[model samples]
Target: MSQKELTIGSMTVFVSQPYKVPQVTELIGRNEELELITAAWLAGPGQLPLAPLLLGEPGVGKNRVVHEVARRTGKDLFIYQGHEDVTAEDLACAVRFSDKSDRKMDYVVSPLVTAMIKGGICFIDEIAKIRPRALALLVSVLDERRYIDSTLLGERIVAHEGFRFVAATNTADLEGNAMPEFLRSRMRPVIPVGYPPREEIDSIVRSLYPRLNEHTGKLLDLFWLEWERNGQSTPPTPRDAIYVFNLALSLADFESLGGLRAMSADGEPFRVDQPGSASSLKESHLKRAMRELLPVSRENRP
Candidate 1:
């Protein structure tokens, strides 16, 4: 096993790869948003990369945009999922007992800390979910002083020259408990990630599920039908659109396959883990799927 520590001054900080580098490289119709993020990363000596907040509702492509930026930058991406229970130690570092070394306690660097040490992009998802106390750990890293002090290790972990930071939060969460002013001051110009246009929605579907190319446009039409039918308050997000097409494809396959039972690997018993056999999506299969994904008026409810 390879060692995972770098001695910063007298303190040894162990690092870890918490989340996999994203393989998704398509941003569909987010050119302007991507450009903004890419420009924010251009920092020179004595300057800090702009720490921007990706503001959107759930299911928008905020996370995917960050992943593609990391890929384009040729830098390893580390994702840290923020939660209500996140603490300062969780943001920076934590000491854990080693499995290989006779119960010796070792420092485990967080995704945020690992990116700081490894000169990569650290995208914290649902950042507003983290408590203010925990979120405060990023103050130094977001400003001209690119470093984080870990109380757990009693060490100041300075970010490498190439390290970059971005955060994402849902609209509802931001309304509940406003982010502390200190953090808000550091994370400038929150980038609102609005829903992609119908064309872009179709493009995203084609990119993700090319097998449904023939019916993607029709499926998108039904998607908007439901979007309008639901009073347009909270339309179907990109994620909802994807699920609609995915389920529609599955439903088409079920009809094509005569709704056969999902059998076990041995073909002895029915399998409960799957939704049944799948196939390419069809236009007719989309109406019901769209209804399920987006709320419809009572008269049109399935």
Candidate 2:
């Protein structure tokens, strides 16, 4: 698939893969706004509100859930990743030296502004990472139903009727790292997505990866079971399951190199927990491997 790009002011953001939103009817049985938000996007232009804040810790599929929702909703998504240095002008537009002009002057619209103009779904990620000043610029857009044209630019930029807003943030210890109550208030509904349940995750993995034979699936299940038992209260999510499966595939080749012959009664690599080998599945080793691939469950939960 072609890598997509969205213009944010003078900068450009490269989009990753196209998301596959879960079915709204299904939505993995979670009451989270994930299904509704994505469903609104699917309904197309001018159907939903401008503000819906998605909050959660990192790597819990917050972005993916939104992307899937957007995909399912059939809305063109304009993604902008928030950073510490981002400012209000960055969300709107900035003055640039136009090569065509001798005075070196022109105002270029940013991704947020362009999304507003084009009526696309504007996805602002990691919003809490940005400073308060940068976030303050959204006050008008979020509340007044209009945007203030920067005094420097000297032109009012009104959002298109189709513009929709979705912002995501991870919880933080620092005050600046949390979305201010003022901004949070503008969003009528704040959605918090928790990690997927084991059964739901297993279902997602199975749907996407049916080729994984029964032995491999069961091995992964055992790994998850062990991790849940020893790790903190939170368990490894489905995303973690995917990582373990990938790691095992790599290990299959490594076993061949180590001269540990791959032996399977049915012509497939033997499951890691098969009979005598179960003792080798240690908690410490599993935790370390999980930490490397997936975010630690305790830190990421909302």
Candidate 3:
């Protein structure tokens, strides 16, 4: 995506496009978490909006929660993906050659900066992946300071009053990564995004794979039985449910098409989309897909 350029205090910078918000049609059974995040965005005497940190396991819907809350508040969403190699300048501003201009340098503002300038919600996904040095840039922005000093731009950018911040980190990184204490202290509420209940999981699977029809409920129940009822220590997350359902349905189609498979690197499998020739998901397909795609299923067990 091409970024639009603007002059911020004499120096021209390319404005970062806020990452497109994924449209979430429904956020099942997460009313309380949303309320807390909304409350964090509130203000009172001697209070600034708390920068909430969403703590969760991978694929447990932390990103979805923040995106839905920001959407409900009618705020534009800016997403910054943090990584191990991210530096302080990368978080604030960086320079790149413009495609339009002949060898002209373009100052590209980061998503964090874009949100501050635009008064949108900035969500730093997998923030724990960022090194301590890079995260130091966030201290002022996340606290009462409400500003970031860009060494490269030689200017201090204050966050707009409407700007809100949220960060999500997987459990392993939050507890074990090299993120600094000061940065961690500023992001508050410590919201924990856990696995959804079985009913919600069933709903998500059904919604995501509606084509499965009668096979949906039975497949989800089998998943629950394999992970929950069988007393496995780690039950399948919502992601696993979606993945298994889609894979199983695909496998069922493959069976209908007489084991027709994708030969391309693009990963597009052969499809049988026609009438009575249409393949339906079955018990065997569900069982086989679970074993093949999910790590928790009986066949995948050591």
Please give the CA lDDT of all the candidate structures. Answer: 0.79, 0.62, 0.82
**What local lDDT does model 1 show for residue 269?**
64
Candidate 1: the clashing residue pairs are none
TM for candidate 2 is 0.69
Worst 10 residues of 2 by lDDT: 274-283
What TM-score would each prediction reach against the true structure?
0.87, 0.69, 0.88
Q: Rank the candidates by lDDT, best first.
A: 3, 1, 2
| Winner by TM-score between candidate 3 and candidate 2 | 3
Residue 274 of model 2, lDDT score: 36
- Of models 2 and 3, which has the larger lDDT? 3
Give the number of colliding residue pairs in candidate 1. 0
Can you write out model 2's per-residue Cα lDDT over 184-261, one digit (the tens) per residue?
777646687678777777766566544454654665566777566545566555566667655544444444344255
Q: What TM-score number comes out for model 3?
A: 0.88
State model 3's lDDT: 0.82
Give candidate 1's error at residue 166 in angstroms: 0.6
Candidate 1 local lDDT, 1-302, one digit each (tens): 35676776666667777455556636787888889998988989766679889999999889888877887778888899989999988998888777765547777788898998889889899999899988887888888788898877888888889898899999998995568889988887699999887778777787987776566676677678766766656656789878887788777876766556543367656434455455565556787786666656666556
Each model's Cα RMSD: 3.1, 8.5, 3.7
Pairwise lDDT winner, candidates 1 and 2: 1
Question: Where does candidate 3 stray beyond 4 Å?
Answer: 1-3, 22-24, 44-46, 100-103, 228-232, 261-279, 296-302
